[model samples]
Target: MGAGHAHKLYRPAHSPVHALPPHCKIAAVLCFVLAVVATPRTALWAFALYALLLAAVAAAARVPAGFLLKRLLIEVPFVAFAVLMPFVATGPRVHILGLSLSESGLWGAWNILAKGTLGVAASVLLAATTELRGLLLGLQRLRMPPLLVQIASFMIRYGDVIADELRRMRIARLSRGFEARGVRHWGVLAKSAGALFIRSYERGERVHLAMVSRGYTGTLPVPDAAPATGGQWSRAAALPAAALAVCLLGWTL
Candidate 1:
């Protein structure tokens, strides 16, 4: 897989979190998310602890709180859906601030907000600490489907290329004094999108043919990433292990 590009989310740092093998961090984040999801919604304190754990991770990763919070804005849509749940969901009603709200809906909203935020935060942290190339390598190390890994590899590699193409197209349109200000411009935008698709498709065909001529196979060649050591695995497992303890407490208490 190509290791030429790092996604925008990656923050270059020299922290321990960044030093661990990508597969170890990936597995740790996965387990931590599972633990968070399994916790009872009523155990609100558990969620607080989960947030603290993530905070500690961010601190250790040398990722500023502002960096993490700004990336977390991507989850605003989920937050919006959760906010609407209290008004739209059907269930037992409760009164607060002279307004009636469904009791179950409130809990539902909390569940979504708490869990979704934690999940998104975890993902953002993972992306922040690991590069796109490292993530692909991690998935490959974890025995993920080769084809899926290849697809992701290609997406990461060419996403910027496509974006650049779109930017250039937009610049050309603007240069011709074309301004899209209303619904009337939808057709032009749609045609532009179609043209971009065709051009991208042709580019893909040419690239594939070039690869085939060079003895391309059904799978991409794997990079020689080092496997995690026992100490590294144990260290990486600490987050999820702590999370598991909290989850069990959430269940038992």
Candidate 2:
């Protein structure tokens, strides 16, 4: 697979966060997201606290500022949708920038924007702290549906393989003077896609056979790993704890 294709997904690192057991980080992220979701939309102070807590976690992980910013932008589209809800949602009218829009819509926008951004931040922080394989192991340990975890595990394992195949196919087509600009090449493109599917299916079967021949089991096992240090545990708990407290305050008052 091209390096560009794998650039953004989790890669292993030697940072403090990376050294922690994946189960702990996964639990913390799940709790943080739930707490953020439970927080009232109007609780601006609570939201700020949640964001700061996430920032603290990121800092402890030693993720670079730009890398973190770039990853967080993945939620921009969702945020944009949330921002637009205030204008299109149905309710009593309010004027903004000379356009009358719904009062309820405005509140809806704020609700999604705050919640979605915080949720994405929490998720990114978790991903940054753990590699994809570790995250999968964490999910497995969490008592998640084994079938779902299996699907995710396979997808993560083969996603790059499929992507590389697509790239090579593209290159071959381009070399053959095929420019996909209009309907003229549509049939050829469709056939190529079908062929790619068949090839991938065969490859998967082969991989499965190989695994079976090598004493394969249904479940992937985690090795006997050392427990996380005190500092790592503290950092993992810090964000979820602060977010929970703030969320409680938001609902109480």
Identify the candidate with maximal TM-score: 1
- Report the C-alpha lDDT of model 2 over 160-251, residue by residue, as the tens digit: 78888988999999999988999998998898899889988999899889988988787555565676678777877876888888889999
What is the lDDT for 228 in model 1?
Answer: 80
lDDT for each residue of candidate 1 in 1-253, tens digit (9 for 90 to 100):
4454867789999999999999999999999999999999999999999999999999999999999889889889988998888888898899999888889999999999999899999999999999888898899899998888998888778888998999999999999999999999999888889999998999899989999999998777776766788999999999999999999999999
| Candidate 1 whole-model C-alpha lDDT, 0 to 1 | 0.92
lDDT of 2: 0.79
Q: TM-score of every model?
A: 0.95, 0.87
Model 1 regions lying over 4 Å from their true place: 1-4
Candidate number of the best lDDT: 1
Candidate 1, RMSD to the unseen true structure: 1.8
| Residue 39 miss distance in model 2 (angstroms) | 0.8
